[model samples]
Target: MNTKFSKLSFTIAVSTAMIASASLASPTVVSFSDATATSTSGSFVADNAIDKNKNTHWEADTDGASITARFGSCQRVDDLVLNWYGTNKYTYSVQLSKNNGATWTTVVSKTSGKGNKNAQNVTDQAANAIKVVGDTDSRLRIDELKVNSLGSTNGCTSSGTSNTSNGENSGTSNPSTGEVSGGNAQYPADVLDLSKWKLTLPISLNSPPNSNKATEIKQPQLKTYTNSEYFRLNAAKNGVLLKAIAGGARTSTNTAYPRSELREMQGDGTESAAWSCTNTDHGMYLEQTLLHTTTKKPEATIGQIHDSKNDLVMVKYVGPSFANGSTDIGKLEARFNNDNITKLLDSTYKIGDPMTIDTAVTSGGNVTVNYKNLRSGVRSSTGTVKMTGIIGSCYFKAGMYIQACSKTDIYNNTNTVCANKNLSANKYETDPYAYAEIEVRKITLR
Candidate 1:
C-alpha cells in the first residue's frame, strides 16, 4: 500500500551518467556453439539451450538442476538472452564461473520466469563460462540461449530470440536480439557492511486490549544483532545470506505482527554504500533470492522495504494462503504489500527451492515486482503502488517476520510469550530464541 529523490534533477543526472559511461566499441555476442554444455540432469541438455533450435530442449530430471555453458577463454559477459520453451515458472540464477566452476558467482538470481524478457543484465563479469541453475516445477524446455555484452554497438541478434516452433510455447515477443542492453555491475553492499542499519525486534500494533494503534510490542535496539548465535548475516559468493539459526526464535510477540527488520540511517540516501536506499529519479532497485525452512501455519515473511518508522510495505510468504482459512497450506504464495496483502506469486516452496525477487521502486509512487520459480522458467510481474512516506527516508529489509501468535494470546492480550517462545523469558534464561531463517544471496541497488 505504501512507499526516491527529486524526480527531474536526478533523472537528468542519471541520464548524463549513462551517456558518459557509454562504450564506443561494439560488444561481441558469444555464439551458442562458443561454449561447452553440461548439467545436473537431462540429455537434450545444456548445449541444447543455446543450439539455436526451437525444436531442441533441455530437460532436468529433478526440480533443481543446472545447465552450464563453459567457454574456452575468459569472456567479459555482462548480459544474456534466453528463450524458454513450454510455459512454466522458473527460479534460476545466471552465474559466471571464473575459477572453472569449482565455485561460482551469480550474475543475477531470477524468480519470475514466465514472460521474462529474453535479455537479462547481470553483474559485469569476466568468466570462462555461464550457467543457469535452480528449481523447476515442470520439465525444462529452454531454447535460444545467447550471451552479450552489457553495452554493445550492435544490439542483440534477431537469431537469438526463440519462437514457439518447438510447439508448447505461448507468448508475444518482437524477437529482436539487437544489442540486448544491460546494466553495469554496481553491487555496493555485502554481508560484512550492514553496520548502518539498526535492528528492531518484534514491533507491531496493539490488538484488542493493548489499544488499537500501531505501536511497538517490544522495540529493543540490539546493538550486535547480526552477530547472534541463532541468527547469521553473511556475504555469500555473489550476494548475502540472512539466516536464523536452524533452531532459532520464531516469534517474539503476542501481536499478529512479529518482526525482525533493518532500518537505514535517517536522510542518508547514499548510493555508494553496499546497497542504495536512495529515493532518486533513477530510484533504488533491490534484487535477492529467498529461501526458507518452515511451512508452518500463520505464514511467516521474508523480505521488505520500509521507511524510518512504520511498516509501509513488504513481501509476506504465506506457507498456505490464509485466505482459504484452512491449514491445507502445502502451496505457498508470495504476497506483496502485506500491510494490505496482494498475491504476487504462488507455488510450493522447499528449503532448496529458491525464489528470485526483483523489485524497483521509483521516486514516484510506482513499484514493480518480478517473481521467478527457477526450473519452471516462468516469470510473473506486478505493478503496484509504493506510498510516499518512505520516499523521504526509506531503507530495504530482508529477513523473517513470523506472524504466528500463541493461542493463549490470540483473543486475550495477556500471554506475553511469543508463539516461537523467543522472548518474554525468565530473568535467569540466557539462551537465544529460535527464528524463522532466510538466506539472501545478493542485493544490488542502482
Candidate 2:
C-alpha cells in the first residue's frame, strides 16, 4: 500500500469538491433584469453591451463614452467578463458603488484593454451599480458584459433559459450572500453601525430633483424642525431611536403620507441625497425590532409584496374599528397613549421584540415576502403567486410611513389613498410634534 498515493487521492477529492461547490455557486447575469444602462455618448447606447448578444455592440467615436448599468437594487458582484473593441490609448475599470453614486470603488482595472475577451475575478463587492469607464483620451466599445454573482442557480446565465425574457431569473436578484451558508443566517446587528442605514423624513414636501414622480400633492414646510434631530443613535452607548413626528396640519381633503421614514442603505447601491427611485435587480429587504411606539392606536405598516397588481403591499396594524365591523384589532395589546392596540406576534412584540422582514422578487417571477417576530416565532406571509411586470423595480422604506389620513384626502386624491395608510394617531400632531415614535434597534437589508 503506497500511503503517499492514498493521501494524494484524498487531497484531490477534497479540492475537487470545493471547486465544484464554488462553480455551483457561481453568479449569473442578473444584471440584465430591472437594470438601467446609461452612456455619456448619445449615438452609442449602453443597453447594447448588456443586450446578451455579443454581436450587438456599444461603440462611440468620442473617447470616454463611459457606459454604466445601475441594477434595480444592491447586489453582490464576484466575477465579471467583458468583451471589448479595445484601444491602447484607454484603460478601463470595473467600478463599484455601495452608496447610490456619491462614491465609487474600482474593483477591476486593466490597461491592456483592447479588442479582447477578458474575465476577471474581482474582489466581491456589494454594489448597487457597475460601470465600464474608459480613460478620457481613448475611444471605447463593449461587445458584451457578462457577470456571475452569488445568487440563484441559473447556470451562470450566459445563454439558454437564462435570458431575462424567460421570466424565470430564478438566480437573478436578491443578494443571497447571507443565505448561502448553513442556513438563512439571522443578520446580526445592535445599532452600533451607523453606516448601515439611512433615515428619510418628509422634512420638506419638495420633490427630490432626482425623483421620477412626485407621490405627494404638496411637500410640507416646517420651521424649527431640524433634520439632524430626527434620528438619535450612535454606537451602543446611546441606543438608536428613529422617531417620526407628524409635521404640519391636515388642511387638505387630499391624503398625504407625511410621516418620517428610514431606508436601509448598506448593501448594493450607492447612497445619495437625491430621492429618485433606485434601479435594482435582485430585491430590497429591511428588518428591525419594535422597541416602542407612541401614538393613538392607529395602524403601522409592515413589508411584503403579494403580486404585481399590487404595489406597496404592507401588513397593517389597524387598532380598532369605530364603524362597528371594519378594523384589524385583537384587543390583548399594549398601550400607546392609553389606547389598547392589537399586537403583531404578541404583546411582548409590541415593545422591544425582534421582527424580521424581507421583500424580494424570485427568479421564477414570483413576488416573495415574509415577516417574523423573532421573540414569538410568529411569521406573516403570502404563500406564493406569479408576480408580473419584469420591467419594474421597488425600494424599501421603514419607520412611521404613516397610513393615517384625513377621510376627505382619500376621495379627493390630495393625500395618499386611505387604504394605503396603515395605523394612525389619535390626533395627527402638528409641526414640531411627534405623533408616532418607534425605537428601532436593528435594521438589515440584502
Candidate 3:
C-alpha cells in the first residue's frame, strides 16, 4: 500500500475508538408504562394494595373500576400513598367534594408502571372524599393507599370556627346592633328622633312699598323670607296687606318698612346694610358727590385740650390760612381728649406736624374717613371734623364800550378867529368782569 493510504486508515481507526469510549462512559434511563393489572375485584380490593415489590408496577384496562374512601367532614385531606409492581401501564384519579355524596371535585390523576413509579398526595380544600380509579394488567399491583387530614381539627365547626395548620383561630361572630336607653330601638332608617321640641317659625322681611303703582315701585318683589318652613307666600303687590297665614288666619303681618330692631340686628347677621335712595334718578350721582366731598384731606392737624373740670375738647379744621372751599383741603386738624387723642396718634407726628387724612371710597360710593396728627394747645384734641357742606359758584360776563367827543364850539369860535382851528375827535372804551367760586365747610364728626 502507498504510505498516504496507510496513514488515512490509521486515522479512521482512532476516530472509531474515541466514539466507542464516549458511549460507554455515560448512560441514561428512559421511563414508560405498560398496561398490566393484578386486581380482579372492581372495588377497593386488598390484593391490589401497593407494596415495595409492586411500587413501580401498574395497569390500564378497558374496565373503568375504582377504589374510593370517604374523608368524612374534613376541609382538606392529603398524603395518599400508592405502590405498584412490575413494568406496566396504569391510569389513576382522585375525586373530592364538600357536600357528602351530592357533589365531587377531581384532585389528581396519573398513569403508573412501565418503569415509572406511582406515588402522590391529593391536596384539596373541598376534598371530603377521594376515589382512586385505574385499570391495569396482571403484571402491575398496588401495595398501599394512605391519607391524612390537613389541619388539627380536620374540618370546620358548626360555629364557623376554622383551625389553620399554624394553630391560628379564625372564628367569626354575629354583629350587634347599637342601643338607645340601654336597649336597641328599631327604626326603618338611621335617624335620631327629634319630635320632642317645636321648631321656631322663620322670620321675614317687611312688605315692599307701593306694590301696585308700577311707577312708584323701584325693585322686583322678593319673598318675605327666602326660606320658610311653617308658612310661605309669594310676594304680593296688590296692597291687600298680605301676611303669613295658617288655616286662613294671619299668623304674622308684614310691615311697610323693615323693623328698626331687625335693622340693628342686620348689622350682625348676613344681611347687608339697608340702602335707601330718596330718588333713584339722582341717587348714584348724589352718592358719588357726597363721597368725594367727605373724603378726608392729606396733611390735616389734630390736637387735644383739657378744661378745669378735666373734660377734654377736640377740634378739627383745615390749615389756619386755607379756606374750606368746595375742594378737599390739606392741613386739616382733628382733635380729641389728651388720653383719646394720644391713642389716635401713631408714631408719625410731632406737635407741629401737618395732619393727614386717610380716606377710602367703596364701589357703592360709600366713603370712610380717618384723621391723623394730634397736637396740644394749637388745636383741640376732642372734636368732630367733617366736610360740612359744599358751596359751588360759577360766573359769566358780556363786554361793552362807550365814547365821548366835542367840536361845535370850536367851529364857531374859529370862524371869528380866522377859521383856522380844525375840529376833529376820536374815542374808544372797554368793560370786562368775570368770576367763579365755591366754599365747603367742615362738619363735626360724631
Candidate 4:
C-alpha cells in the first residue's frame, strides 16, 4: 500500500476500535443531564469531556480535581468509563450522591490505571449524581466520560420535562407542610455564608391595615432565622430553599411583585450596601436550580444587580409559551437595564437542571453576565454593556424574585391591600397557586 494511504488506514482502524470499545462499555449509553467540575485548565473545560468528542479533552488545573455528572432524575447507573488522554497511569475514584451532591458514597477506586481507556463496574446503584475524583498528584485529563444505565427510565419525568420535585415529591416530607424529624434543623446561614448579607421576605412584619412593607432581616437575626414557608434549608439540610408566592407581600407600597431574596450588606450587615460603579469592580456567582414557577406566568429573576433607581442587569428565566401565540419553550436570559435582553441558554433549560450564573461589573460601569446550563453543558455570555454615563450606585440581589403577580393573588389575601391595580390577572386556575422556588447550593461575592 502507498505510505500515505497506509497511515490513513491505520488511523481509521484505531478510531473504529475505540468506538467499538466505548459501545461495549456502555451497552445503553446514558447522556449526562448536567456536568460540572471544580476547575479546568486552558481550553479543556469540564463540558468538553462530557460532549462525547474524543478530539476534545478536559484537563484539570490541579491534582485531586473532580467532575460531577447529574442525571435529570434518578438512575440505576452500573458502569462508568473514563477515556484518558494518553497511556499514562492514573489513580482515581468514583462516588455516588443521591441528595444532589450534598453527600457522597465511594464505589470504585483504582490505584494503577493504564492505557487510554479505563472501565469500572459500579454495580446497580441508585443515584442522581456521579462524581469522578482524580487521586493522583498530576493533572487528570480525559477526553470523554461514558456512563451506562441499567433500567428503562432515562430520568425524565412523565410530562416530558426534567423532574425537579421539591421535598414532597422527593421521597422526603416537606418542612413547609410537615414536621422534619432527625438531623438538627439547618438554616440558610448554615448552608451559605451569609454574614455579609441580609434577607428580604415576601411578607410584612405587621398585620393588615398596617404598612405592607416587606420584612427585612439583618445580621444577628439572619444568622439563626429559618422560615419554613419562605427561606429555609431543603429536606436534606444541604441547600437553601427560597420560596415565594404570588400572593405574598410586596417590598413596598410602590413595588408590584413579591420576592424571597437576599441583598448584599455592608460590613457586619448593620448598613445597606451601596457602592458607586466607578469605585471598584464587583462580581457575584451562584450555583442554583429553579424548582418551580407560577402557572400562567412561569417567570422569575434569579439574580441581578440593581441601582438605587432601576436594575442594571437581571438573570431571568422565561417559561414556555409564556405570552399568547408565543412559541418560546423556555430560556435563560440576561436582561440589561430592563430594556435590552440576551438569551444565554435556550429551550433546553428545564425546571430542575443545575444552573451557574456569574456576573460582573467593572469600575468603568461596564456590565457582563455568563450562564452555564450544567445539566445540558450549554454555556453563554453577554459580552459587555457600556453604562459608564447611564447608571449610578448599585447593589447585588440573588434568590427567587418572582416577576409575576395577579389581581387574584391580591384578592386571594383579602386582608392586605395592594396599590398596583394594573397587575396582570391570573388566567390558569380559579384559585391560582402561584408559587416559585429556588434551591441555592452555593453563592459568592467579590
lDDT of 4 by residue, 47-151 (tens): 566667777665655556677666556665565665554565667677776655544668877788764656666655566666776655556666666665444
Of 1 and 2, the candidate ranking higher by TM-score = 1
Candidate 2 weakest ten by summed lDDT: 6-15
Q: State the TM-score for model 4.
A: 0.60
Instruction: Give the winner by TM-score: 1 or 4.
Output: 4
Leading candidate by TM-score: 4
Ranking by TM-score: 4, 1, 2, 3
Every model: Cα RMSD to truth:
17.8, 17.8, 47.2, 10.1
TM-score of 3: 0.21
Pairwise TM-score winner, candidates 1 and 3: 1
Off by over 4 Å in 3: 1-62, 72-75, 111-116, 121-124, 138-143, 150-446
How displaced is residue 436 in candidate 3, in Å?
Answer: 99
Q: What tens digits encode model 1's per-residue C-alpha lDDT throughout 1-446?
A: 11111000000000001347665444445543222222212123334455555665544434455555544444655556655534456676666555444335676677876533445666555565555665665444455455543332221122111111111111221111101111111221222233334444442234333311222211122222333322343332333344432122223333434445444432232231222333442122233344543323435566666554545556665654333222233334434443665655645544445555555555554565555555343345555555544434555665556544442332334334433555342211112232345554333232
Best by lDDT: 4
lDDT of each: 0.40, 0.38, 0.23, 0.63
Q: Compare candidates 1 and 4 on lDDT and give the better one.
A: 4
Ranking by lDDT: 4, 1, 2, 3
Badly placed stretches (over 4 Å) of model 2 are 1-198, 205-229, 234-239, 248-255, 264-285, 291-297, 302-310, 321-349, 388-391, 405-434
**Cα lDDT for residue 348, candidate 2:** 27
State in Å the error of residue 48, model 4: 8.6
